[model samples]
Target: MPHDQTTGIPPLKHALTRLLLILAIIAALPAAAESAGKPEAAPDIDIRTAQREFRLSSLRGNVIYLDFWASWCTPCRESFPWMNRMEQKYSARGFKIIAINLDEDRSRAEVFLKKYPARFTIGFDAAGKSAEIFDVRGMPSSYLIDRQGKLITRHIGFRQKDTAGLESAIRSALNRQESK
Candidate 1:
């Protein structure tokens, strides 16, 4: 093994490390390209929940609220009850709330679920592939998707004051879907 005298490390080892990094970036491209910001089609999510496998495309004709959350996030804990209410209130009207948990440890998410049960669909994404596709930038990021699967709006954090506006957006999307 030829040593790089300047760094005192083998040249072959450094080249292999760089090659691995490049390969990882290349592998991530397809997932990043899957979804973008608002006014575009929502990314397809094929994630497994404890109950069952969830697919975003399966609910194509319904207005969707896609939320990215983690078990340890306080705002995420606050949002669950509100989301449950929304799901119960609007599910019959072709509205669906799909909350994806991004906790790296599945056990933590399970514990959270035990404390605050979700009425709507809950999907686990321990690897964060779905979150990456959605370009989630915060602990609790929410995206509203119209019936046609287009991303309508996004909310970054959960606050009691924000509920009314978020509900309004959900209602508006549902209404718009009804009209069309």
Candidate 2:
């Protein structure tokens, strides 16, 4: 094997080193492309509830409505019934709603849930860590994630009149195909 006079490294070893560097750069291209303009992946949610622990990744391949709420938020109260209806209407079509409560007091959330009655999955984040992960800026923020785990849209608040528009977004997501 010929040695490189400059650093005493073997020519074959130097060639292999350059090849590895090229391979590493090629391996990073896809990740760079994904980060450049592609839709961002929804942040994972690992939260606990009274019934069981919930993970956002478990519902991959389903369009997800990830909502962050608190007990004192009046708009959250209004959104629960609509979310329940959406869950019922879309579950069979590969849609799931995971609403995470940001209330520090679990009892407050329990009382609120008793009144609102969520049919969708409920996650309790008493420490508000999930809210921070989602960058929740308001009480009733919601994110619509496509089936491929990309975030499609975010709604900051809920209103009765927004029902049709929100449902339309969900339907569009349900109908959308994964980007090639």
Candidate 3:
């Protein structure tokens, strides 16, 4: 038997091969696209000192700014004063700022805290469990949570160089709560 000139192979075989290749390509496309903008799931955290579990779910009904920092992070050090001011300004307005420290040594963190005292609650994530939960890729990463306890925004790095924008975010969250 002579093969088809167009495909240089049997017609049925060529068609089947082409069909399979197309299906394969189509199947692989979704996986690639899915990875591009995957939504991260929040991790579980325990606030032992506070005698409360610090899961993301518990933050609902309060506007929260969760800052992930360490004793060694320069930006974190710079941002501390601003964070302190934010805590003082928003605490009575149903806004809570939680600073999750990614430090291994509590003593080091405590010493650092003395230099930059914070009015807000501070939690230690010695094993980096909270960082893993929050999908923190860098120091000074912040997550703004609405009153409903849902994550509204994720800030990867600190560029404000001051707390002006950070205060704005807190105010925005407070405003959003008031509107609703």
Candidate 4:
């Protein structure tokens, strides 16, 4: 009797080959998905200064915790200390914090800074351009921007317990930059 070519291969061998192919395809999916969804680092977004004329880009080689806040916001005020601490701890490791004040009056920002005494870089968004660009809907909103200038995460509200999570996120961003 002549053997059928399809049946010549053992059933176990056919099943094993199919399983291997499925596994290989599954392994490739994650890489393809990541490549498709990965965000391009945008380090070129210039921040408008307090005078509402000068545009300045945030630091390029650092993880930037860009906090959009107003002096009158209680939650913004409360988050200041935690932000300051994170700045103090990570500034040396290429981590930077930029407090962009949303107040129309630069004096309000100056006063708030005086009271809080943040060591990180401060910028004034007197014309509210930063808020509009970042789409800030409320005070105390923050965006964690990676070293390559891609926005990694955004938080709309401030909570004391979130400090660790934010710090870890910054660290992860830094690590990703370093690896690349």
Candidate 5:
């Protein structure tokens, strides 16, 4: 094994350095392939709302507020009214809110619905397959999907104060589509 005496680094150390460089390059590939600040195409999940078959892909031309919520999440209630206002404000302009309930039991979600009762579409995903696709990190995770079906941004949790930012993103997304 030839060693670099001047540098005091052995041949094995050189090999390890090369291995580390390869690992680092491999680790960065996925993030590199992903376009920075570009919205990802959402998974078109087969889901049923209380009143309709909510085909996610059918909303290509419309801005989407795709939210994941569970009945037990308290912040979810706070998001409902804001979503309602948003829907009312933007629905005519080709915007819609789709709240996916990740409750294990539909009855619990139904009960919560009776209380917070959203004016927007509510879809049920008892198996949480949709959540897995979205890579939801929190109880009330949300994705702001643009009119072209690309994700604009995501919100991890909800609060009354979060509405301003959320609304701004929504407006920006809506207007961005209108121009195109």
Candidate 6:
């Protein structure tokens, strides 16, 4: 009996503690696995743009600043001007910003655009095919893609504070294009 409970803890307490620990560990798993690593190619996006057909595969030779946006997403609105500036600043250096609108209704996207216009290629993904391929878990998700179509960086959410970091990554990706 002395060795049976030498630690001074009861069996029920020990079991509950172990169970809670396991549950806590289980809760941490999804957070730990959130990263979508570099993919060989971004999802094949063939969507309608205001001007013409927009295809991700067609832009294979340029650094692509791909962003998933929704009309209701406030951060998506904030991202537009920053992305527009980026497009103007870097387009001459072979960079392209492709903002994929994911509003369920095209009219919502149109309305949103009337408020926050993007200067780059704005495409429609009403069916969410590209967002599915990218495993998007949040609004305004974005990815930096290299000239060879490799997904270089995946960002889940956007903040106004995130602009500089995002721009730096884009600059790094654009610079890589010069060497190749």
TM-score of each: 0.77, 0.76, 0.70, 0.72, 0.80, 0.76
Cα lDDT of candidate 6 equals 0.85
Where does candidate 2 stray beyond 4 Å?
Answer: 1-37, 178-180
lDDT of 6 at 8: 74
Put down candidate 1 lDDT per residue, 1-180, tens digits, no spaces: 689889877998888989999999999888777653337878887968777896888889999899999988999989999999999999999998889999899899989999999998889998899999999999799999998889889889999999999999999988877887
Task: Give lDDT per model, in order.
Answer: 0.90, 0.89, 0.78, 0.78, 0.89, 0.85
Q: Cα deviation in Å at residue 92, candidate 5?
A: 0.9
Model 3, residue 149: C-alpha shift (Å): 1.2
**Candidate No. with top lDDT:** 1
Q: How do all the candidates rank in terms of lDDT, highest first?
A: 1, 5, 2, 6, 3, 4
After superposition, candidate 6 runs with Cα above 4 Å error? 1-39
Candidate 2, 85: how far from true, in Å? 1.0
**Could you tell me which residue pairs clash in candidate 4?**
none
For residue 121, model 5's alpha carbon misses the true position, in angstroms, by: 0.3
Instruction: Name the better of 1 and 4 by TM-score.
Output: 1
Predicted structure with the largest TM-score when compared to the true one: 5
lDDT of 5 by residue, 1-180 (tens): 678888768989987998999999999988887877566787787768877785788888999999999999999988898899999999999999999999999999999999987999899999999999889999899998887778789899998888999999999888888998
Per-residue alpha-carbon lDDT of model 3 for 52-143, expressed as tens digits? Answer: 55565676678888888888988888778877877787788888888888889888888889998878888887898778867799988998
Q: Report the C-alpha displacement of residue 71, candidate 4, in angstroms.
A: 0.6
Candidate 4, residues 1-180, lDDT tens digits: the string is 344477786667777888999999999999999976776553344565444433335376778888888889888878888888888888888888878877888788889878887776677767876688777888788988776677788898898788779878988887888888
lDDT for each residue of candidate 2 in 1-180, tens digit (9 for 90 to 100): 789999799999999999999999999999898876678898987968778986788778999999999999999989998999999998998898889988888899999988989998889998889899889999799999988788888899999998999999999888875332
Candidate 3 Cα deviation (angstroms), residue 151: 0.8
